[model samples]
Target: MQSIQIETEYVTLGQFLKMIDVIGSGGLAKWYLEEYQVYVNGEIEQRRGRKLKPGDQIEIPDVGKFEIIE
Candidate 1:
């Protein structure tokens, strides 16, 4: 598992994905989100606008695991 430090109260899933290079761009993130299975705190999340806060864990199967940090 890896940690992603956020300087705000929350970060949108798309923004986080782009910041961490999961997707090349916002548009790609939006498109690819539907194609891939993303989990937050062990629940499948398909919304690109899903709000992720500190301590939230995101897992992308076969890709990697990441945790949000303040």
Candidate 2:
């Protein structure tokens, strides 16, 4: 897996959506979440505010893996 650095100490699921430009805007994160297309460590993650710590792995079907790093 590859790693992506976060400028902050930690981040949330919504922050990730914004970070990667996964959606056109922040509001799109909510809409995408409703589609249930986001995953963490291979399992579907439904919480928008789920705390993402260093070493966490997030998987988006078309986007591949995004492993968190300092």
Candidate 3:
């Protein structure tokens, strides 16, 4: 899994996507979420506002796996 370092207590899914270059802009988060399946902590997640903290795991098929770190 790829490690994503976060400087804050948590980051929103939309923000994370941008941090990883998954989306070019925050505005694309909604469209991306609707078009793809994002798994968070082993559960399907669709909310762009979902808060993700350190140790959280995120999986996107074809995109790869990632883990949040402090």
Candidate 4:
């Protein structure tokens, strides 16, 4: 699994995607969510505003696995 560090208390799923280089801009979060399957802690997630904090795990099939860290 890959680790992503954040300085804030939390990061929105949209911001996380950008941090991981999955999307070019925050505006594409909606489209990306619709086009791809994003799993948050084993459950499917599609909200761009979903808050992701430290210890959270994200899995994107065919893409990669990620973990949020402080």
TM-score of each: 0.93, 0.86, 0.97, 0.97
The predictions' CA RMSDs to the true structure, in order, are 0.8, 1.3, 0.5, 0.5
Model 4 TM-score?
A: 0.97
Screening candidate 3 with a backbone cut-off below 3 angstroms (N, C-alpha, C), the clashing residue pairs are none
Candidate 2, residues 13-65, lDDT tens digits: the string is 98888888887776677788888588898789988888898999999888778
- Per-residue lDDT tens digits of candidate 1, residues 1-70? 9999999999999998999888998888778788999999999898889999999999999889999999
Q: Flag regions of model 3 displaced more than 4 Å.
A: none
- Give residue 20's error in model 2 in angstroms: 0.9
Expressed as tens digits, the lDDT of each residue in 1-70 for candidate 4 is 9999999999999999998899999999999999999999999999999999999999999889999999
Better of 1 and 3 by lDDT: 3
Model 1 reaches what TM-score against the true structure?
0.93
Count of backbone collisions within predicted model 4:
0
Model 4 lowest lDDT segment of ten: 14-23
lDDT (Cα atoms) of all candidates against the true structure? 0.92, 0.85, 0.98, 0.97
Any residue pairs clashing in model 2, and if so which? none
Model 3 lDDT per residue over 4-43, tens place: 9999999999999999999999999999999999999999
